[model samples]
Target: MTARIGVVTFPGSLDDRDTQRAIRVAGAEPVALWHKDKDLKQVDAVVLCGGFSYGDYLRAGAIARFSPVMDTLIDQAKAGLPVLGICNGFQILTEAHLLPGGMLGNDHLHFICRDQKLRVENAGTAWTSDYSAGQEIHIPLKNMDGRYVADPRTLDELEAEGRVAFRYLDVNPNGSLNDIAGITNAAGNVVGLMPHPEHAVEPLIGTGRTDGLPFFTSILKKLVNA
Candidate 1:
């Protein structure tokens, strides 16, 4: 059966359509999910696309963390449902406590937009299985509150357990602790990242690089095997 991937669109979301397209490009069915709706439409997996949800009110994704959809998402994720969060979506995951750490303002205090370099730190997660550990890829990074912060113990645990799925390479765009660009939950089913993979899935667009396609394909493979 073809995998059905849901893309959630919260208020002020700007990349839901792009995420859907990337899912389709990866040969999966794209399902649109609303932030206020509890129904998942039977999607095999979910992606929280990047955007300034709630206009970044009350700090980045703070307000959106309590959305009705997240109520279900949090439960499902704990039950082994595969989920990926990008940019502001990453912020929401942290706020909901589905993932560790928090996203703070960039150290430079600027909304940065650039093609970023990252190293795949973990290859066993549901969303990163297709990538080899240490593989370098480029994806677009754009946001203001993009710096990832966590306590020293949490950072150590993440690193020791191989939950750090991606690490910034070359230049650290937002001064994220330990150069973390993305991380996976202990179960490895949930992943969140600062860069926008949906924006990098097509070779004819943006940076003309398709390095981000592996993320969608990785989940599709996981669903098929499951």
Candidate 2:
């Protein structure tokens, strides 16, 4: 059976369509999941795409974290369901405590959008298994609150457990400690990042650099071969 990947749409989601397109391009069925829905529709995996959910009012992802779907997502993720959170989705993951740390405003105090260089520090995670360890890729990143902050103990634990999935390669745009860009949960099923991978999956796009395509492809491959 073809793998079904769910792309969630919150009230203010901006990249739900793009994420669904990327999943379809990767040979998976893209299922549109509503924020209020309790059923996952049996999607093999889920992608929480980027956007200013809930108008980003209280904070980037504060309100969106309480969405009803996230309640199910949090539970399923603990049971090893594959979950990928990108950009504002990453913010939601942190806010929901699915992932450690929190996102703060950009250290530069401005919204940043650029093709960012990131090293795949941990290729064993569910969302990044297609990449090789230490491999570098350039992907589009855009956000106002992209800086990842964690306590010293949390940082040390992540580093020690090899849970740091990606790191800034050349320059840290938001001054994320240790140049962290992405991380995974202990089971490797939940992954979160501040970059916009769905935007970088198409070749016809700028630079024709489809560096982020691997993320979608990896999940499909994992599901198909399971």
Candidate 3:
């Protein structure tokens, strides 16, 4: 059966449509899921696309964490449902406590937008199974509050547990502690990242690079072979 992936749209979502298109291009069915809706529509997976949800009010993703849909998502994620959060979506995951750590303002105190180089540190997660460990890829990353920070103990645990999925390859753009770019939960079902993979899936658009296609494709392959 073809995999059905849900792309959520919050009040101020900017990449929902782009994410939906990328899902289709990745050979999966794109199911549009509203932030208020509590149903997953039986999607095989879920993608929380980037954008300034709730206008970044009350500290980015702080307000949207209590949405009705999140109530179900949190429970489902703990039960092994695969969920991918990109950019602001990453903020939401952290806010919901699905992913650990916090994203503060960029170290430079300015909004940043550019193609970023990332090293795939852990490919064991449901969303990154297609990538090889230590593989490098370029994807677009744009956000004002993208610096990832965690207490010393949590940081040590993440590194020791192999939970750090992606790390900034070159100059760490946001001064994230340890150059962390993305991480997965202990169960490997939940993942959150700062870059925009949906924006890099199509070779004809943006930077003309399709390095991000593996994220969607990896999930599809897993669901199909399961």
Candidate 4:
């Protein structure tokens, strides 16, 4: 069975097409979802790709949290629909309260872009099953407000519950608490991360590594086997 995944495109989304290509490369159909629409196109899963949605002027992903598409996306996500949010998409997830924490400007006060190393801390999430716990991988990372922050109580809860799905390696690029690069919802169906996995899916691309392909493949496998 072929899984159809929806990729939401906000007005200022920069990586929608690339994410769509990655979905196709994973042997799934990519469904383009517009910001003004609430219908999900009956997709089995959804991805909110990296971008400066609605122009990150007032804060990344703040405006996108209210998009018509997100109305349904939020509801469906709560019902166990698999969702993966990357970069600004991660910011949106926090705003929507689908995931914990908010993003702040990098501690260095500058946008950083490079191939980043990450350690998979929880490989059981819907988007991470193809990887093993403690596995290390490289993916492209680029962001301005990328530092993840949360209340101390929330951080303790997440750590205790194994919700921290990935952590920065080599360097904590954004000074996020606990070196968090990604996290998952308690249900393991929703995930948010800062790195651009879609960019590293093909070996001929960025770092000549396909470390990110497993994300798309993992979701496809989950949906097909379910």
- Per lDDT, the best of the predicted structures is 4
State the local distance difference test value for candidate 4: 0.96
lDDT score for residue 15 of model 2: 96
RMSD of 4: 0.6
What are the per-model C-alpha RMSD values against the true structure? 0.7, 0.8, 0.7, 0.6
User: lDDT per residue, candidate 2, 5-47, as tens digits?
Assistant: 9999999999999999988888889999999998899888999
Where model 4 places Cα greater than 4 Å from the true spot, the runs are none
lDDT of 3 by residue, 97-161 (tens): 99999999999999999999999999989999999998999999999999999999999999999
Better of 1 and 4 by TM-score: 4
TM-score of candidate 1 relative to the true fold:
0.98
lDDT of 2: 0.92
Taken over the whole model, the C-alpha lDDT of each candidate is 0.93, 0.92, 0.93, 0.96
- Rate residue 155 of model 3 by lDDT: 99
| Collision count for each candidate, in order | 0, 0, 0, 0
Model 4 per-residue lDDT tens digits across residues 31-89: 99999999999999999999899889788899999999999999999999999999999
lDDT of 1 at 86: 95
**Residue pairs of candidate 2 with colliding backbone atoms:** none
